[model samples]
Target: MLHRLVEPAHKQQHQFILDRLVGVWLTLGEFMGDGDYGDVIADRRVGVRVEISEGQDRYVCPACEKPMILASHRIQNRTKERFYFKHLFDDGSCSGVAGLGEKAIAALRFGQTKESVEHQRFKFRLLESLELDPSFTNTMAERRWVDEDGVKWRQPDVQAHCNGQRIAFEAQLSTTFLHVIVERMVFYRRNGGRLLWLFRDLDVSHFRLAEEDIFYSNNRNAFRVTEKTVELSRAGKHFVLECVWHVPTLTRGGVSDKLAHGIVRFDQLTFDVSRGGVPRTYFYDYEGARLQAEHRLAERAQTERDQELRQAFENFYLPFLNGELNSDQVETEWPELLSRFRSRGLGLPAWPDNPKGPFHYLLAAYSARAGVPIGTDHEDLVKLAHYLVDKRKHTLWIFRLMLEAYDQKEVMRRYDTTGRWLSKVKQYRDAFRRGDSHYMPNRGFDDLLCFLFPEISDKLVQAPGTFLGSART
Candidate 1:
């Protein structure tokens, strides 16, 4: 059955333990790493094992060339594991055995870049596509540096020169390792080096997706929802946003897909401070609501402004964009002006009237330049439909705007339902859950909010022929 409501988390300590089990949902409290046989490689052969320090069953020692069978048994109830079920093999299971419930961690050749393209080459291409030129090439990736203070570390990222200062880069993958990378960069900067994180394909392991739905019975089209949390604002409460985006590093989900040739791959914050010039993010303690509301407002306002900017491209700004407005012609012949019908068949939302907003100015200019007077005619609308439907790539500005708008719509819906009571909360709360973790009240939000937060359509974007998988977007 589907979960109807959520309750609070039982223990905050579990969150710390939970972060280590990077991939997949975990109600099981165990630190799982991918490898086998005690990180040992003998005669160039790799051995794998599964060891659970805590749980019903403990460790398993398999015989060489064959899965081991139990040769003895014991039970210990006072251990971390609630169940003391034991399997012993005195005959041959282990050459050496230690630790309770020990098993080899699974091994996955998870996030290797394509063999044909090196990471540096791909990054150079990406920078070139972005029109960025590096002034120097002192990359920090795997480079050892010893500062004047005897501090030493290796940079596993990029270091470039830009605009007369050194630029440091940490091309981070979307995993818990990101925290380590960012920490190193932070340390580097503290010791006097100009560095900026050149964020790569940020979305990787998020469980989210976007899909459009058509309601034939109601003669309406709607977007379907899922278990994804789309943050309307990039400035607040978004530490996990990068995790989903960084999932490109995690491949090998199944037996066939793990080794499949050329498998598909893919894939912010803010706040304020009471006094410091440095930014201080106000989290969920007391000031979270204010920060949340403010950022949302900023995003909403920004989206509207972006739409206006798009309009301006077709109107007054088109000449500037195309380098033609200043070319001449103080006053063109009336016939010539009348004959131009470039954007005659386009439609869009009405230009906003908030003159104080920069959006208004941007829209006024662009739409006018293209002769698409903001949905002035059926032809204009048809032109717009064609542009949106037939276009291959989506506009980031437009995408951000739409996302912001959708977020506002959801916010409005939730805001109105604030005081309402959920009938199934108690019933669902009473339901039993597996594991040693206790129940908390916030998982209640998890139950209901999970529905509100739909999955992303796409996750990380990887190079062609890469085995890394992307998000569903």
Candidate 2:
């Protein structure tokens, strides 16, 4: 639903028409004066027409006070569209309209600090309409309020108290910064008042799913809009507002349920508590959209972290994998590698010479992190666990560190057979005592090696049981 206001629009052509008309010398009567432009006002107000014609009498440019005349021309669209504008004399006299382009046209249309007469007209109308509601027992326009302590103060455009709740209605016709809006809202709320933002036109260009617009109601925990109010104003030929509920990230089902309380507007010329205050945002499916957004943020953060770790794995962890490092080489490099991984937001798999030695644990961690499975099946893990728990005749220590490569939740959810394997392993661990297995002192070495280094299981079968004993102990 996010969109940018694409430029080089037909509206720009309208501005060109307007600017050219302004450039021609005009009689005092022809000029609409400050706060009004016929080109702009006529387009918005139905039944009102703008008639720009060629002026015969000598005229003075408003910009340079040089001789000018209304110039008529046709613009090329799909068809030739007639447009008339004021043309200044080109006797190398007037500096006005000398170097005009799209920028100048845009400035003529939009770059104005003073409030247009139309904007003022709409604001006053809305204020008068608000006063008509009896529920707003206390209402004032441009009211300045100071708290009893005199520490907090505010001057709202239109302030009212309805049913003991203080509210300020702001009708915005131009763009405002997010921080300023938030600041005003916070200041009002802190003094026990709520600020309602009413936009003459919603800036769809700035709308984003993740960001909250001015219409977003923090108190009600929803984005609220008075659709009826907007429609009512439109009927009076005041202002037009196009409201859009952005829902690109939301799911399909139960979207209506989350929006039940989001739209507050007058129903049948009467204000009701149920429908006329502030409407909940129908755009976001409350929990679903929030969860999705949070998931995306989390995924992005994890991706950033993973990239760092992957870089470290490539630079540091890869060299240790070829089984070429000596004990001293490993001892010297292992700490730095662990530190680097941790610094880069990657969790170390195990302590050095932990349940298994550093090499086995590193291999498992690398395989898991790299998404490269070492080919150990679920049954092999069960067999390894069973052999360790049930077959050992004597034991210095017991270890249960195989299957460290896989996530517990993933194992539980993705493989139904893993549940049975877990139960079998648990059964043996719970029933067996220390010296009650067949393969004493060196039990489960082959199975452990097979489970840990499945890619080289045949070679690992010939590996020393001392390594397995060292791991178990």
Candidate 3:
């Protein structure tokens, strides 16, 4: 069950997140309010406020002013310190264990909306992950530094040190933060620190208004996964995320996302800052090389599919659809779902020479690889689709696969089995849908992406950091 996998990671990540939230929450205390723990509204009749501070702690109630007796106590001393839970209330009216949780969240004023809370928890996880990494040490939160104006201002969020180099990380939950990217980057450049940006998801309105342009790229891949449903989802759960590396820089537009989120992390990262924190040109080259290697390994693992099964996804599902999805319904009810795909390189040419159809096949193939089901309406499916399509737009997925395999094997075999050159194709429409997870595209269709690298490079140059999650300022 999803719970089994997430519960453990949830517990661990929850603790880690709470620790990081301690800093963020505490830093926001004054802005939120000065009381110990309280949540009330303009209509005081509606909300709850539990004030605990000074003399009020040993006792209970602002009314009692009485020295309260300890009703019970359980204390176990350990190396980490001790666990102590006691009840002493002059008023004897408190929510108890459940109240404690409610109060904590109320103090933060976290919204109950799923995305909002998830983002909050995610920000906590991001900070925590950054803290524990050996690559990032010496965490600094809430410090005053003088800017050029000689005026003192508080920092954006957390700054950390690794290998004697300090890096600044800002979790942007509002659109206003977008305008500050260049300023933040300037800070990084001036302070000689690497910048880690956390931008709000643009598609969602929950986040505040933000700028559109400061990032490297917004192109992500598109795909779908059928029969895979989320198991456990909660305020306290976490997921492990992985960085999709090696898509080629010019193609990718230079971007990275915090993995080990959405799912709780299984283990610590090896913490390789050497390859990280380098100039964009450096990182781009590394990803390009790795992607080349991955394509070869993947094609070899392909399984044989019968023609019958191929037809199931071909006419209607060459991209793996059993039939055409209802466009009328999707556009009416989930218009953004369509926009999400179109936004992520769906319209881009797979390569320079041949533009339209190859790009479509590239999206289709990427969807197959990610285990994602094809459709534009469902939220889950849309995200998966966005991821793959974005990848094709940036990597020229089809072409790169062939280009890399050729570079590795010195001969293109499989489809032809004995040919030194990869099968040549007059057009991408030459590709065939062999059914579920199977594709026998036209010759050279496999190299559709790579053939257009020169053009992709030009685009990258014109719009540096324009794809991936680059706008997450």
Candidate 4:
């Protein structure tokens, strides 16, 4: 009796399940018996899957074309699992509705319809446009195409051949599942065909998620067909579409995108087949422009950061140089300034004694590089250079090296117009050559000098052995 009951139950199984979204049907028994069917049911891959809730009307019965609900039940002591589809409203309208359960009202929803009037009109418009274009040939509407494996097929709204390439145009007027879009793209790509998703209209000011799904996935390009485009195609005697895309722009804040659109002939668009994981179509190179904008934004940001850092350093150092802040006070505030530099991946050398700190050395170097006074009341870099050589003999060699290394030969020549500074420099050079400790190189500030002026770092007399080196190490 038990064997007879099992045989009868298996004989009453539903024949097939239909996915209305992608317009694909699958044999129920064959899909259920396949080992990989679990992945399909889980919606983990890009293929046909019954993704309907208990009351939702996504999948339907193949025989009656009525909404179907998935039913699951356990059998035996081992908790064996089995799943099947039954009519949501079983009113004796179909044979597959028997022994399922009580019926419920099917919810009317958008995207549940097979095709809308707008979608059909858009399809016909594309068909007409393709027929008008001399570059396209063998154009057909609602043509079915089989993949290489012959296991899957897609009936594109309009199909055509362009320059020895198969082109399938899908008119999208409503929201489509991402998997549906990806599956169509994969199918067309595998069959050596290109799929172009067309929109009836697109509002750049506001973008629906579905529109973005198509726009962003196609290299930030979205094409639309309307009366204007169709008229243009008729006038130009070629296929035309209003192509909308994002134009990368560099702004004060950062890189931004500006919406741009224009009516373009089909030949103006690029048919890119080398790219993978995206629709092989675009009107402009948005990705390339975005990368260039990002690079320029980075350069602008770095320039701004350098300006802010220079201003802050001058603000802090000027006051101390004029004796408004003592060594202890400068030391107290040094760490905070150092923290800011550290945040920008720059390391400052340790604070030296007040009279011999980096303040004067940096001021002289900056003034010389600018060809004008930066911190002090000196009229020109010549005066600053003279002052450093006369009063700060300990910094003479490094300052002289900076002047020469930084390409300030004119300033040096102007400083020695009367030969006074030059004579003094020669005396200091002679003393240094005679191993005079008074004119020895300041090795302690090598790291700080390098950090402040990286151009002359290679010309420093000694190898860096300070905080900059230690931090990098």
Candidate 5:
């Protein structure tokens, strides 16, 4: 199941890891300095080095080369944690047979704990802590506590009796599935035991660590109180796990309020509230981080697009600014347009408010109304009437120029790109909706959209460049 989800890049990385593990395994055996004489050291020789036992180092399957975990098992009546290489996959072709079964491997990978050195250390530290506690002197590591049918319930990293309560302290470092955690919790609680899950610090990308609630605020919130956990440990208090509030910033390629990790007591966990009465499930909190990254990427792309548009706008209008352009030839071919916008009153807002001003706005609005790219057709009438209802702006005398434009679509583009010219004028909206072909009835409509008189000049601002594409940039 884990292998199925591995992306191409991750698969390559996993292959590299597998190769390294295999290399280490191939070099660990020392049988008369000859590779063929590989032999397994008996459990009686605790510190001996052999093909199977490589001192205190990690091991991998001799056949598949998948990394293995060193765990405890009773051997010759002595139980101790030892270097035991296990296969990661259930490949029958592999001659090695000492690793965990396929189901166990699947559970371990789901919990994101495959070949985790940090997880191993945390387990050892928890055991040591419990051993030092007077109330938990009966604490033991890797104890096979069984169920009524002699079936194995759970082999916690460290199990102890604290204050007359059986506790299972788990240093959860991997992305364990929710069902697994819930199952273990229910199993422990039913058999007179309580489960406490602990997490490492905010190392978000450790085996895709950030995708879990170990650092999230909602649902499966886990506090990251590394210092507090240590302080409490020193004071011999009941261990408290940490929780964090992972706040995502969705702005111009940056985030705000990023410090969202903290500590929480065991009782504060939601699972404890209903542990015995019913089962509770939790989810991963990594979506916040994923969304933030996506937003930042989108903002960056938009910025790049704006820059491109600005460059194109400059190139197109540079000839006019340098007096190298002449619309006389164009005017002759499209006489109606030249006559309609010939007057300054009929034009869009001028610079320095807008660089290309009326001319650019006219082209962009026409292009948008036609659903065509800019400069595609110079003679098509701007569509205005079709979009008047959506643009929700009052009719303008400039709209009368629809004799040379599409009345419906052009009207919508003008209203959208033009500033809130008729936002406060209720009668203008009513008049336009009724399809009145008369003069704009409201005074604000004429003042805001048609005239540049001093009384309403203060309200006028540069409209958006929605239709102009890069020209507005």
Candidate 6:
């Protein structure tokens, strides 16, 4: 019972040191239901936490299967912050407490240093193309540029000055982390320089995630430098690039863009730095084209809706006019048509006690404007015109204006051999002027007439005296 326990104390001290070592090694964690372990360092570099706040995404230690949380640290006087995963509860049951041995760290460093031959060749070719252009000056390969604050710096693959403007070009050959790309863009923008990301080729059918990120962000445009482009540059004695862009087109589904590419000179491209100091360089105006395409699609949709409404009205009104439906049936169905018209911002008066009188009057006015019978039993436009002037005297003002607005006087003259229709119109005009006639204007029926025949809307707003003065002399 009094035996000394010296071994336990020594083992506890060793475990404490191992815990610290494992803490440094735990940079990755697995999100619940996700097979891959998300890299916290990359997330921190981009200032976006994949797991976000606590409990947002259930993350666990990749090796120990214990609950984990994202942890961050910033050393004094350093601009960059470090991020890693830490165990929620540190019970010393996990074998990862021993840390990742030295051999594994060495392999990681070796793999990062081994750059692909293709990437190196692309860098050299881009440098060569810049040198061939006389417009470019002070062009260098792998130059380190310091920001204005002197707290940040970036070493672009190729840098140059053209037209007193600084431009940096980077060749994307393989998978590059989003953080690295974003950081470079921010640094260049703040330093008053333009950054252009170049690629070797693009497979639009099988676009990589990285390619999509670049393509969509830069006005749906991507640039490439291929062997053919370099040869053209050499022959033309200037800088050239193969530009790939999306041309917006209206499709049956919606507005879509098709892929288009061409060889363009450096000077031929638009270099705009107006939008929030972010540089936009492209051969085509993708934004403008897309906006125009969207506007066209909206107009087409509106036209189609107007035609559909016109057809529905014709179907209901023609049957009632042809004696296929009785007045009771029309009264019951008139409310439904009113509801449809209201949906399109067209308001009509409620169903009256005698709907046929007003309905027939409106049908006569529409038939006159259209130069054909629409919902009336009249055999021709002249007959409908005579009925409107003789029976619907209260609506005679708008009916005359509609005739002049739609150029229906010729049809009236062609049929009225005795000048009866013209004489009736003049007699009504003289009586209305003398204020001794039943030429009252019904505002409700006028609105209904305008809705049925929109061509006379402008003329309906004019004063009766003003409209008649401008009428055919």
Candidate 6: where is the Cα deviation over 4 Å? Answer: 1-117, 132-134, 231-238, 267-281, 285-288, 321-323, 352-361, 369-380, 387-414, 420-473
* Leading candidate by lDDT: 4
Residue clash pairs of candidate 2 = 24-86, 261-280, 262-279, 262-280, 263-279, 263-280, 264-279, 393-440
Q: Rank the candidates by TM-score, best first.
A: 6, 4, 2, 5, 3, 1
Error of 4 at 179 (Å): 3.6
Error of 2 at 210 (Å): 22
Per TM-score, the best of the predicted structures is 6
Q: Where's the lowest-lDDT run of ten residues in candidate 5?
A: 4-13
| Candidate 6, 420-471: lDDT as tens digits | 7667767777765665447756555665566666677676655454556422
**Model 6 poorest ten-residue lDDT run:** 5-14
Query: How much does candidate 3 score in TM-score?
Result: 0.26
Error in Å for residue 468 of model 6: 12
Distance from true location, Cα of 471 in model 4, Å: 42
- For candidate 6, list the clashing residue pairs, or say none: none
lDDT of each: 0.28, 0.42, 0.33, 0.66, 0.42, 0.64
Instruction: Tell me the alpha-carbon RMSD of every candidate.
Output: 30.5, 14.3, 23.6, 15.0, 16.9, 15.0
Q: List candidate 4 stretches off by more than 4 Å.
A: 1-120, 204-209, 234-238, 248-257, 268-276, 285-302, 352-361, 366-473
lDDT of 4 by residue, 161-277 (tens): 999989898866655566677788888988999888887566755555666788887788889887888888988898999998999998877888898989887877776643454
